[model samples]
Target: MWLLIAVSVFVGFLIVLYLASPLITPKPLDLKGVHVLVTGGSSGIGKAIAVEVAQRGANICLLARNKAKLEEAQSEIEKVLVDKNQQKVIHISVDISKDYAAVVQAIQQAEEELGPVVLLVNCAGASVAGSFEDLSLNDFKRMIDINYIGTVHVTRAVIPSMKKNQHGRIVFISSQAGQIGLYGYTAYSGSKFALRGLAEALHMELKPYNVYVTLAFPPDTDTPGFAEEQKSKPEETRLISETAGLFQPSVVASSIIKDVVSGRFFSYAGLDGYMLAAVTCGMSPVTSIMEATQQVACMGIFRIISLFYLDHFDRICRKCKQERSDPSSEKKTS
Candidate 1:
């Protein structure tokens, strides 16, 4: 009798949770006729996101430091617009990491051309990988400048307008490295991880104004940036990253867009992404009761699984260290 009573109570609780989900869930944002500004949209995942939103009928503004690449991306995005005659795409050349006044000016130009930005995608970022001791101070500073402060500058410029409008969506394209610190990513991970703190605090301040924030944790992706990152990765970092595998830029962009429209606080790509998001969820805002329940139920199991992953990574680091210390090991293997 007690066992049956316990099961009945649990089922009743789930039913109540499901019915209450809508109260906390934000209405989905429509992309049609909306203005979206994508930083770093001249290439890679940023370009892919611009194409995705263009297909949804949003006017696009691409921001990057390279005027040539921005123009090239602008033309490509225009080709995918749902309304060729009505929809428009424009590009601005500016380094978001530098001068706040310049960022504000660039945003003004975009809003003047396209209208107030309904969505802002903070995708401009940089990565540098090396042992903590080997990395130059400039490397660390550059990563923070491009990945963290750049997002700050752009978001700061847009917030007042968004608040006045009382509706907006923001996306921060942080990497899987942002979720978990790994070998050779001391500088890169620190910068990416800073995004989460900013996103969380900003979400709180903006939620009352109906401005939603989505922080995306994308795994290793096949992009020009990813290719460059690979060149600087240590052997241990490479081995650990290979376990999750590389995803295409389109896939990552699509996932991010889906979450943004739904007003999800955390966005992730792939199985590994789902696991990390759940395990690290910790006090972050939830859009639905279902999401909260899943995190509650699965976090413990995912934490256990992560231990095995950590062990494997530790083994890789030890092996790499051994090979480096004993030069003869390379000859023996050959």
Candidate 2:
């Protein structure tokens, strides 16, 4: 009993010590008159981001699959921008999942119509939630193709232009699933995790040329698509998503734009994010008092604790890498 009390007191003291620890974040980058591209600009988070950027006096090029939705979102963005400074927003309709050439062409056209593209926000991504047994192989392939490959396609398409300009910012809107594996997210989580490796590599490669890449690991937010996701979420998934605050689209838009403009490498929108990020970033040691106090203590009685979800994620990632290495041999004959 004394030992428990002593440990608790020690942990409390440690937290108090680090409570005022300095946070490492970036200085704000200017956005005035900059041309920005937002993939998946039709609805949900992408549309919100477009609005935020427009309000900041930047020219925006909106891209998404749906023509009507893209037009609708474009109107909203322009209206908001006009209220701020009487400026207009450009919109392009392109199917990101297919037609890489067309998407590139549309971007070029937008550059011609609007101005030079300097900021790229890869906000367009999606996932279908389901267990491994129930989900189809084709569905899994599509998830990777859109979530992972789509990021590559858009970023690669814009690199030459950005390199010539010598200044650019790329933000990929990754999810919590990508940060930590979750129940019934085999396909979604696998591709989402791929972004971390991709962004880390690109950050190192692009830093010399004045291009900065930011990967955003946002918790669940209330977008138009939330109702659809709720249909298949399991209890654990639902709980985590809810714990993330179910924030409105506007809040995410505002905060994410702030993060991108400020050149933040990583950001958690609120309190839970701060706690979750600290523990996960140092999972090897979990040296933070936050872990020693409430987290591990809660799971003490479980004699057989397992990082089952984490192991599954690692195995699938190895499988993903093996397939990427020899696409010709691992190529789907189906």
Candidate 3:
């Protein structure tokens, strides 16, 4: 009798939770005719996202430091527009990490041409992988400048309009490195992790005004930036990342756009990403009861799985260290 009663109560609670989910969920943002500004949109995942939004009928403003590349991306994105006559795409050349005034000016130009940006995608970022001591001070500074502060500059510039309009979506394209620290990512990981704090705080401040924030944790992707990153990656870092596999830019961009439009607080690309997000989703805003329940139910299991992953990673580190100390072992294996 007690077992049956317990099952009944659990089922009843789930039903209630499902019914209340609609009340907590934000209405999906429509992309048609909306203005979206994507930093680093001249190439890689940023360009992919611009194409995705353009296909949804949003006017796009691509921001990057290379004018030539920006123009190239603009031409490519223009080809994918749903409305060839009405939908427009523009590009701006500016270093988002260096000059706040330049970022502001660039934003003004975009808004003047396209209209107030209703969606801001903070995708501009840089990565440098090395041991803590091996990385130059400039490397650390550059990662922080481009990945964290650049995001800050662009997000800050767009806040006023988003608040005034009382409706907007902001996306921060943080990597899987942001969710968990790994070998040879001291500089890169620190910068990406900083974005989470900013996103969380901004989510609270903007929620009252109907503006939403989505922090995306994308796994290793096949992009020009990723190829560059591979050159600097330590052997252990490369091996560790390979376990999650590589994703295409289009797949990552699609997941990010879907989450942003749905007003999800945390966006992730794959099963591994979903597990990482759930494990790290402490005290973050809950978009729906279902999401909250999944986090609650899955957190413990995911944490256990993470421990196994950590052990495997530790083994890799130990093996690498052993090989370094005894060069003969590396040669013998080869």
- Superposed model 1: Cα runs more than 4 Å off: 8-23, 330-334
> Which candidate order results from sorting by lDDT in descending order?
3, 1, 2
Which residue pairs clash within candidate 3?
none
Q: List, residue by residue over 1-334, the lDDT tens digit for candidate 2.
A: 9999998997777667467322222346677788889998878888888888887888889888788888888878878773455455878877776778987898789889777688899988887777687778987899888888888888988888888887888898888778777767888889888987888788767766677777777778777666777888654456445545777777878888887776655545676565554445532212234444444554433222235434544555555446667766456733
- Each candidate's TM vs. the true structure? 0.96, 0.75, 0.96
Error of 2 at 50 (Å): 0.9
Q: Which consecutive 10 residues in model 3 have the weakest lDDT in total?
A: 16-25
**Tens digit of per-residue lDDT, candidate 1, span 11-103:** 887788778633277789999999999999998999999999999999999999999899899999989888999999999999999999999
User: Pairs clashing in candidate 1?
Assistant: none
Model 2 TM: 0.75
Encode model 3's per-residue lDDT on 1-334: one tens digit a residue. 9999988987887788777633367899999999999999998899999999999999999999988999999999999999999998999999999999999999999999999999999998878899899999999999999999999999999999999999899999999999999999999999999999999999888888999999999899899999999998898998999999999999999999999999999999889999999999998887887787798789999999999999999999999999989979988988
Worst 10 residues of 1 by lDDT: 17-26
RMSD of 3: 1.8
Question: Residue 132 in model 1: shift from native, Å?
Answer: 0.6
lDDT (C-alpha, whole model) for all candidates: 0.92, 0.73, 0.92
